[model samples]
Target: MTAITKGAPRAFVLLRSRRRLDLLDPDPEAWTDEDLAGGLSRTMRWGGASQWEHPLSVAQHSLTVLAIREADGALTAGEGLRELLHDATEFMLGWDCITPLKAQLGEPFRALEARLQTAIDARYRLPRWTPEDYALHKRADRLAAASEAMHVVGWSRVEMRKTLGIAETPLVHDPLSPCAFAPWEPWPPRVAERLFLERFHALDHAHRSELRKLEPELRSSLVLTGAEHAAS
Candidate 1:
């Protein structure tokens, strides 16, 4: 990675929409699903330090988080969309900091992340996170973290709970079923990107209509299935 000179003109990333986006001062209008999917597919969680052969990408992690949220309870389309893109701005920023590290980075980092997140929220038409929303999101996130640490990074459950501050052990795995919190496996980046976009449209009001309008094949992919359909 080439270091940006301190006094130099800032660099811009050209999105698939042919929009030039300033990362330091991003415009919500400059990003799209294609940009998010593509960027996030390539950004790995834990900075690609997992014990697995392939590192878990943030795109796959986002999908997992959304799945956990959906499994939790009945959610409105907007709520589900919020869970899906909770870390959406990280895709554009190209890195995810751990909670401790983020605090250490101080106010400047927080400000930048806040601005980026606000822009991302605007782009997706997601409402601001309510206190209830934060509590819900945090629970699901910690559960996912515990599962990921245990499965992908080979951390012991006790270690995860005590060392990583993950208190949710019940979600570590389901002894009764193979579906829930089974294990973390890295999805192929291309597959992750496509599925992330599919999930986004399935939850996004405008995009859901657009998918039905523009592509029938996409409609099949977007429709709620099995338990989800029943639950909905």
Candidate 2:
């Protein structure tokens, strides 16, 4: 989606689905998983300010968070799925700001994001965020941020914790080492899109009973296509 600024010439985005999404006032019906995946595959996180050659996309970051939650082994199947989709809204809406900048943007920015998130949650039949889920999400998000900071952005642990408000004790563990937390390298845009969709399907299959409750059209639309799976 194009940025919604006061005098920007382009005010709407035309998705591959031929749906025109209004930047200032997005219509939920105009969105689709295909559109989201494509957009997020291109949207850069940290406003594209990472040390890596390719900027970390929100889709990649989201998959890492779900992986962290799954590795933690405390959340249920539904909770794990929720973790995978916590940033789905960011997929449709362009990723433009970080946590600290969010405060500067104030309530308007937050309210808009929340509105998009609510629509996404309803479409997927995702349960409302319970207090526990919120806390866990925060922890997982911070853990990912710290990992990205230390590894991708090349920040020290002390700088990450002190500046980014990351948790002191790491929550995400290294898959290879099993003794430390490390960041996954940012994938190229195409790889990131495929992996994001692959993870989405994997989580959906693991939690189908919970996810199938969504509207049939939504459920079908959300499923990864044969081509996507093949590519991933």
Candidate 3:
């Protein structure tokens, strides 16, 4: 099923939700959280190369990043959601290209990705990352990559540092071990999907609850501003 109408660009894919999403001009509402979770679960990282039977999935990797952040300290719902969805555009693209490959894909690919990400952010109402927060996020992400490289992708610690140029040490313990599938074992796509959806829903609910709590304060602030303008 195509979302593109007559005279529209033919750049769409039918989602598992039975909705069509245009790759070039994505609609935020076109896909559900379930769809995103499924897609991420199916999308493989490290170009689908893994030491385990199943390839490491973006879904699991996303959860790994979230776990790393949580291990550090408590996170606001918004921050947790942002970390979980960092590579969400990959789900829409259906490919998790490595860094060198992304460079080869160039600006057009990046622009499309940015557009899709904007749609996702709008759908989730994710908060904008402050510079400090973004820096910390990058650190956690890189640490996750380093650990995945060694544990799942079968790279040596030396290779991770010298070849992959990852400065962080690979983690000895699996961050997702609490999920209870297996330590350092890549999960089946279905399992990944289920886990991803579970986390997404949990974080999304907390985020919405946070928003609801702020609504009254927001309204009061708006009313105060209006009153000040009237006095002026």
User: Listing every candidate in turn, what is its Cα RMSD in Å to the true structure after a full C-alpha superposition?
Assistant: 10.6, 10.7, 2.0
Screening candidate 3 with a backbone cut-off below 3 angstroms (N, C-alpha, C), the clashing residue pairs are none
Off by over 4 Å in 3: 1-5, 178-180, 227-232
Task: Decide which is better by lDDT, 1 or 3.
Answer: 3
What tens digits encode model 3's per-residue C-alpha lDDT throughout 31-98? Answer: 98889999999999999999889999999999999999898889999899999999999999898989
Q: Judged by lDDT against the true structure, how good is candidate 1?
A: 0.75
**TM-scores of all predicted structures:** 0.77, 0.75, 0.93
lDDT of 2 by residue, 1-232 (tens): 4445787654477777888877556666777777877778888887787786788888788888887777777765667778878888776667747878889999988987887777777666666788977887888788877777766677777877787767555434543221222345677788778777776776667677655565686756657575577789
Global Cα lDDT for candidate 2: 0.72
Model 2 — which ten-residue stretch has the worst lDDT?
174-183
Q: Candidate 1 lDDT, tens digit per residue, 97-164?
A: 88899989999899888888888877776756889878988887777777777777777878877887
lDDT (Cα) of model 3:
0.91
Whole-model Cα lDDT of every candidate shown, in order = 0.75, 0.72, 0.91
- In angstroms, how far off is 119's CA in candidate 2? 1.2
